[model samples]
Target: MNVEPLVPVTEQDIQRYEEDGVVCLRGMFDSDWIERMRAAIERNLANAGTLAIEYAEGKSPGRFLGDMFMWTRDEDFRAFVFDSPAARIAQKIMRSQKVNFFYDHLFVKEPGTLVPTPWHQDQPYWPVQGSQICSVWLALDRVSRESSGMEYVKGSHKWGKWYKPRGFDGKDRYPEAQGETIPDIDQDRAKYGFLNGDMEPGDCLIHQAMTIHGSGGNVTNHTRRRALATRWTGDDATYDTRPGTFQKIREPGLRTGDPMDCEMFPRIAT
Candidate 1:
């Protein structure tokens, strides 16, 4: 399989990402990568990681499942993390000297799933601190607003604000998390200048760590939404041993304020 991006990350893409805090890159991955990731997803569904959560269990029109750190256990995911073009894309867009592979988060929204993901900033939930942190959300299937495509508040990352992290069930997963609760964007959505739309398989969205984003429920009766978000940290990122945040993998044995280039979060590109 090709390890390079099918479509290169251009200067325009980087400019958009910097301006909007999010950018959609079409055809970033080829069909081969998509098919391999789809197979990996099926494998993950059969054997989920320790961090997997079924938020919509027993109380939904459909199912909502999420898992993280699959690369530590799954070969395909591991290969993708180190050999795929994601790291290169991240480094170019972030304009950093190097890139580190943080972790992979998978989201599966079955048809008719009605559990909306709460609006929040990702950095607050992570044990990291830096503007270079970002996530590459790759679509494994066709995605639309009706199929739970992610929506982001344009340029929210530059708001210099951090929102409290909340679970998909509208509950505080981290009671001790430090941040102001996010505003009710759903009630007054018109003012946010939200960005979201349809995406074909192999398309991906890259967003800054502090970008405020969330997704709606999958109201479709047949189409399922499956996406994998790979987190990456650039030159400025460092370990943050903040209290109240959830760490998916084992401790990296690094002190706070240290560079995140250990074995766990290995530097992938330079």
Candidate 2:
């Protein structure tokens, strides 16, 4: 894996990220990183972490598997983190002078998994603040809307609201979460515009932390939908170590509103 920065980040790409709150980049990651992430995800699935979750088992014909922060436990994940284009992409999307590692996330939909991920913002669930935070999700398999392709509300990050977090298991990830409930964008699809596209291996979707986004399940009977997400924070992102959020684990010595650069969330780009 090679973490080469995207040389000459395009002005148009930056403009789209600023206006739409999300953008999709293609061919930024090569086959090496893609293969490494696939291997790592398979290994993580074999030995799932204590926090790993499986949904739609028995209730449906497929399973939705999710896990996070495997970089601490897997060599391939670590290599990808420190050796992939994620950090560079994050830096460019955020338009920041520096970027820090946040965490790694894995999502899998085997087939016929119909559960839709609830619409919500990512920043409210995390222990962080500031607009310079985002996640880059890479599709390891060919993904379409019917095959659990992630969708984002165009320019939702500029809404300046924090909605309560929702879970994929049809439960509140934060039961006692405070804030406005996300509107039924999917219900009133015409009222709110959406952005989604087919993605292949090495293609990545960069979304603002405050952007409202979610995905449906794999409707196909045989194809698999595999996606890996790497989250990052820019120069201004800081910790908000408050309790009762959707976040499960906490890093040491990071008090409320401290700069988010530590061993757990190391500075990745500058």
Candidate 3:
């Protein structure tokens, strides 16, 4: 099937993204695409079944589902990522002649869930080097402040510091930080700080791998915040599984500083 071509990203959008480390594009997807993705998610939930973690206990049968990397596992998702405009946008933003797929993460936050994602940077958790990676967070639902959407620290990507990883339960697992508070700031709620991401269905926000970001717990009733995040990197990106790093398990074959040109990270655009 011939999908509509992606609209060229505007210079204004690129400028804003560079300034704030994130930019939200509204209605980037058509209604038909959104519906198709929603349906695909529903199918994945039904067939794969939901993994009930401590945080997602007592929720709907399929309130939280994730990790749909092998697009062949779901036809609709494959079409959305390949046939849709997201890949082109990612290619343009990285300012590279080519862009490759890293992975796809589906975050489904059910209503009234108190499991907040801890403040973290994707770079520290990734098994790759360089700043060529970015995540395209596309909301599958109407996301609002009440629905616990993403919040990013302004220009945090340029800080060049990779902090220790924390659990999704918001606990610092590193022994050194024991009994100490996580010093990261929630730019959304901070006084005189910047919190610049709230998106609707078909609207997506892109952020650098090093950008500090996290989300609050869902406090609203019956608000489902589902996001489809597709990670991409430039041709220069490489695989690196640092020893003693949890990220190593995700990309086992990758060695430190090795070019990330494996089939898993296929070049989608050029």
Candidate 4:
């Protein structure tokens, strides 16, 4: 499938992303593309036996695992990531000769679910080191501030603080050092205004790796907040696993500090 080229990211958009740590782009995908991805997600959700199943008794599959990347096993998800307009936008934002696919995550929040993602930076959770990494948060459904959509801190990416990682269900898991307070956006919601990503099907929000972001719970009935997040790093990115964390690099031909040259993380345009 040949996806059309995205409009070149303007100087203003790049500056905005750098300054605010998040930027919104509309019409990145059309209705047809949205439907294709929606169907792809449905297919993966229906076939429980296809991918690695992490089932919890007496709970829906959505509640148990929260659907990590199915692209590694599902063909439809693979096509969506490898052969879609999403990859093009990722390359444009980073302004690198090539953009490497870090990974894909599928976050599905079922209705009335109170699981909140704690305030943290994506860089801390990642196994790589670099400031070039960014995430494209494509919402497959209508997202609002009340429905626990993404909330980011404006210009927090420049803080340069190493935060602790917590469970996605909003439990603290980080060992606090002396004089270190756990990242909490809820404490001062007024000072750090919520950068609510109120997005439609074709709209997408791009954020930096160090940006402080998290979401609330899904309270509405039958509202599915499905997001396809594709992470990318610049050609100068490197792989340095954390002490206790184990990251499985799916793509081959990647060295520790080498530029991303694998096919899975392709140079879509440049």
Candidate 5:
């Protein structure tokens, strides 16, 4: 279906991202990119990576899934990283002179999946550090709040707090790195303002790594919620291969405080 090709990022988009810490880019990805990623998602599912994890299993009525570093094994994902406008958009939003590829993540929730992604921040789980990191979450299917759409706490990035990282099942990502526990947004939605949008296949959400966000379970009877989040870091983001790293794909041999260079975090845009 020939979606309108992704247009150049507008000034307002950057403003929204900076102010709200999360922005929805309507039709930010072309149909070709969407199709390629959909295919790549299927391939990744068929051959799960070492970091792939399933949140729903035996006796579970639905599928709550996860995977990482797909670009290493999938050509389509590689193309999306190097050929798509993701890096360009990231560079503009981050207001950075250069952009680097961080990694990729895939999350799928089949119909009837009842597991909600716990509210959490992204940076605390990672070995990298900086405010220039961001994620472009692309939807392969139409998504709304009820369909497990990602919900963000507006301006949570400015909170200046590093919350604990927890698994989809609510376990801590690192036992010793436990900082503050994330508030239960679902329990008190009114206390903390949230932003969620209905997104089409070609649409995507760009959010800061420090932004607190997560998705609910898929309640639809037939629709599947499949999403791919390509993370990128800018000039300010640096390597910190400390212990308790989250989703450590290939260790880019850089010492702590070093710039995120090397093949693992290749400079994608300048």
Candidate 6:
């Protein structure tokens, strides 16, 4: 399988990511990567990892399932972390000399899933700190607002504010999380300049860790919304043992302020 992106990461894309904190790169991966990841998602659904969370099971209208760190145990996900174009893409967009694989997360929203993912910043929930941390969200199926396309608040990453993390249940994930409360974007959506659009299979959205984003429920009666988010950190990322931060299922074994380039968060590109 080709590991290189089908299309180059242009300067404009990098600029957009820097200025807006997110950029949609169309057709970055080919069908081969898509199919391989799709199969891997199925395997993960059947045998969920230890950290898997079925957020909507028995409580919501449809399913909103999530799991992280699959690359530690799944061969397909391991291959993606080591051999996919995601790392190079992160390196380019972040303009860093090196890139490390942070983790891989799976989000599956079965058709008619009515659980809306609450708006929040990603960094506040994780045990890491850096400006170059990002997630490459790859769509394995057609995506749109109706299918729960993720929407980002344009340029919100530059605001230098960390909103408290929220879970899929629309409740606070950490009661002790210290940060500014998220603005009621839903109440005043027009003022935030939410950026979202339709994406086809193999397309991806690369967004910085601080970007405030969320998605609606999978309202399509029959179209499933499955996505794989491969997170990568660049040269400046480091371990952070902050209070209220969620611990990784498999600890990275790095003390506070250490570079995130150990066995778990292996350096993939330099």
TM-scores of the models, in the order given: 0.98, 0.95, 0.84, 0.84, 0.95, 0.97
Across residues 234-264, which tens digit of lDDT does each residue of candidate 3 receive? 8678886664333221343656787777766
- Over all chains combined, what TM-score does candidate 4 have? 0.84
What tens-digit string does per-residue lDDT give for candidate 6 at 1-270?
668889999999999999998999999988999999999999999999888888887767888889999999989999999888888888999999999888888999999998788888899998888899999999999999999999999999999898877666655667877788899899997688878999999999999999999998899999999999999898899989887776477777788999998998899953
Ranking by lDDT: 1, 6, 5, 2, 3, 4
Candidate 5, residue 136: Cα displacement in angstroms equals 0.3
lDDT of 4: 0.69
RMSD (Å) of each candidate, 1 decimal: 1.0, 1.6, 3.8, 3.7, 2.0, 1.2
Model 3 spans > 4 angstroms off = 1-7, 49-55, 58-65, 68-72, 170-192, 244-252
Tell me the spans in candidate 6 whose CA falls farther than 4 Å from its real position. Answer: none
**Candidate 4 lDDT over residue span 123-239, tens digit each:** 776667777889988888988876668888889989877766654544343333211344556876777755775788777889998888888777777777777788878866777
TM-score of 3: 0.84
Top TM-score model: 1
lDDT of each: 0.90, 0.83, 0.69, 0.69, 0.85, 0.89
* lDDT computed for candidate 2: 0.83
Instruction: List, residue by residue over 1-270, the lDDT tens digit for candidate 5.
Output: 332236777899999999999988887887777788888888888888999888877536798889988888888888888888878878888999999999998999999998888788888888898889999888899998888999999999998887878777766658767568877777888888889989898788999998999888898998889998989999889888767668667777899999998898889853
Residue pairs that clash (backbone atoms under 3 angstroms), model 6: none
Task: After superposing candidate 4 on the true structure, give the runs of residues whose Cα lies further than 4 Å from its correct spot.
Answer: 5-8, 48-65, 170-181, 246-255, 263-270
What residue pairs clash in candidate 1, if any at all?
none
Compute the lDDT for candidate 1: 0.90
State residue 107's C-alpha deviation in candidate 1, in Å. 0.4
Which clashing pairs does model 5 show? none
lDDT tens string, model 2, 19-109?
9999999878878888878887888888888777786765677789888888888888887788788888889888899999989888998
Off by over 4 Å in 5: 1-5
Top lDDT prediction, candidate number: 1
